[model samples]
Target: MFLEREEYAILRSHVHADSVDLVDALAATGLRWSEMAALPPRDLTLHGSRPMLRVQRAWKRIDGGKALGAPKTKRSRRTLVLSPYLVQPFKRNCAGKQPNDFVFTAPEGGAWDSGGFYHAWTRAVSTMRVGRPRSPPRPVTASPNDRVSTTSVTRPQSHDLSHTHASWLIAKKVPLPGIQARLGHESITTTVDRYGHPLAMLDDEIIEAIEWSMNPMAA
Candidate 1:
């Protein structure tokens, strides 16, 4: 599931200072976690009229360690445009790094493993109370009724941010093809199948047009 704007803000506020840029980059670009982890400074195009992130390789976990390899699919190796707001975070991340150096590295200057990234994300989200606690039917207990509490906390995987980004684009009415290209989906059908629900936002407008067509006098 995708994060709402306020929840996203809360999550961002709680990210560790060292990982702020990494989290920001994920939210901004919607790159897969592996892609983000393997991004190099050279992949960033911050100077040109169209700033973008060049997706090349991803960090893949092997038997004993990790390796940088081509993206999951050829389409996944496409370039994505960056919003102006995202440029500074990328710039901050690129500073003092060589072109070949990874843009977002671990504290020890290695590719960030999935485990470490998950830990950092958990630490950031643990601070906030996400949703209301549900009161389950009082457990049948021998003693006085103890409340069975269940809170709906939003524990989004790092990849969910990519979903969030696509949701935002869909909410803003970006075209399916554009979204497909930005997400590097090999087929427009993939993008549509994944996010077509958001297009329901047009339901009311469609209904209005149909009504107008049925009764010209109403117009």
Candidate 2:
């Protein structure tokens, strides 16, 4: 499930202010929540000509709880260039922290736990689509003639941002191999299987590009 740019903007608004950066970063970088949650100040290079985020570690499930460990796959350990728009947010998260300090934290402090974030995400999406939560279904006890109206909306998992990221890249015509590498897919086939088709909305853009390529007037 991919969200258009403006739709993403609305979803971002529904998340907590402290989590806004994390949400934006996820949409921007395609980092898995575990990789993102485990990011440290040292992992980000927010200055210089090429600002980037280094994904080396992730929070992995352990017997009792979880621990910082290698990512699920070696390919998942990769570097992602940051768009200029994310520079300030990344830098802001990096400031006043030691190299090992967590970059994205909960409002009360400490690294974010996945389970804890679910409630916030649920609430945000519940109201995000209709600008309010859906109405409950009518109880069986209600009269047969009673009206039962409810709003139906998609509650996309936060991980959907990863797919959304790939779609955005596809829209921009970023090469499949490049996107595969950026997304750290273990195999190019995974990337192809997931996002091979260009979005229908891009047909016009594709035509325009083809025309420009055939003409010397393209600048």
Candidate 3:
């Protein structure tokens, strides 16, 4: 369900101009939907040696309206490195905004609701035609006697972009601990449990490593 680069590009091209920055930031940093919606201007640090985003609060849906509160977990309150692609967009989004202003806001300059964001996402994705099947990848099969292990691979909703981000990192061979830190997972086990599938293209390398370990003198 993760978007290929071309798919991502197509989707981005179709997103409303005002929302492009917000969507890019979500894909780039894997921020939770709520966290992204509640992001404040003061949380952005673009001039330091390393640009970063401090995830602090999230928009919560209460009885009759939305409310702001601390992130769902203590570990979720962390800083994420900002990719170069995200820097200018974020800067533009913050221009002339007060410190308390949400970095990404609705057309009326208010916290975005899940429904509104989903509608926009649906519109953008509807126009996309360059990617693989949008359904989740099939589970890798093991021996008949072994218990089936399924990895999280679906992007059924926009929120699944977080899983896509983690999958991309895992495919790049980034360590689980590092991915956990970046995604703000409470534990490394959670990161691994959800994204531990070895990418199909990496199978050769995995086999070679195993062979080398078992027969170091053969070559």
Candidate 4:
């Protein structure tokens, strides 16, 4: 399920203060929760000519629990361009911290493990979702402008934020290969499979392009 921009805003507002920026970053960068939770201050280049975030590592599952490992795939180690909105939150997180410090952290301090972050995500959704009796569950066929119901979105996981990010970019008409790179998919096939349905919306642009090619101002 995907969330419209305003819905994302409402979700962010309800998230606990410690996690609000983490949620914002996920929607903005399309980074995996592990990739994001492991980010260190040094990975953020906030003031450069090209403001971006480097995906260097992630918390990978292990026998006992989890550990810092290389990214999920070779492509997952790529860099991501950040929009203007992300800089302030990143800067605030990086303040007075060493290069090795986690950019986003739990309320008690240090990086957020998956379980801890999941609880935070669940709490925020419940506040806006279960609390609103009049709000209807999001129908499968809702129009483009419809607001997302956190409760109705089928038990949203923190990972959905990544999907929501891609949906936002698709709405802006970004190409599939571009979204693949931003999302760090090992192959374009993975991107297409996961996003094919929503990408159908781009057929209108494809038709317009074909029309342009078939005519040269009737000259």
> If scored against the real structure, what TM-score would every candidate get?
0.83, 0.81, 0.81, 0.86
Whole-model Cα lDDT of every candidate shown, in order? 0.83, 0.86, 0.79, 0.85
What candidate 1 gets wrong by more than 4 Å, as runs, is 131-154, 208-219
Which window of 10 residues has the lowest lDDT sum in candidate 3? 147-156
Model 3 C-alpha RMSD to native: 6.5
Candidate 2 ranges beyond 4 A from true positions = 130-151, 197-219
- Predicted candidate 3 versus true structure: per-residue lDDT over 71-133, tens digit per residue: 989999999888777889899888999999988888766777788889888888677654443
lDDT (10s digit) by residue, model 2, range 28-110: 99999999999999988988999988999999999988999998898999999999999999889888999998998887889
Model 4 regions lying over 4 Å from their true place: 130-153
Q: Report how far residue 201 has shifted in candidate 2, in Å.
A: 5.8
Ranking by lDDT: 2, 4, 1, 3
How many steric overlaps does candidate 2 have? Answer: 0
Give the number of the best model, judged by TM-score: 4
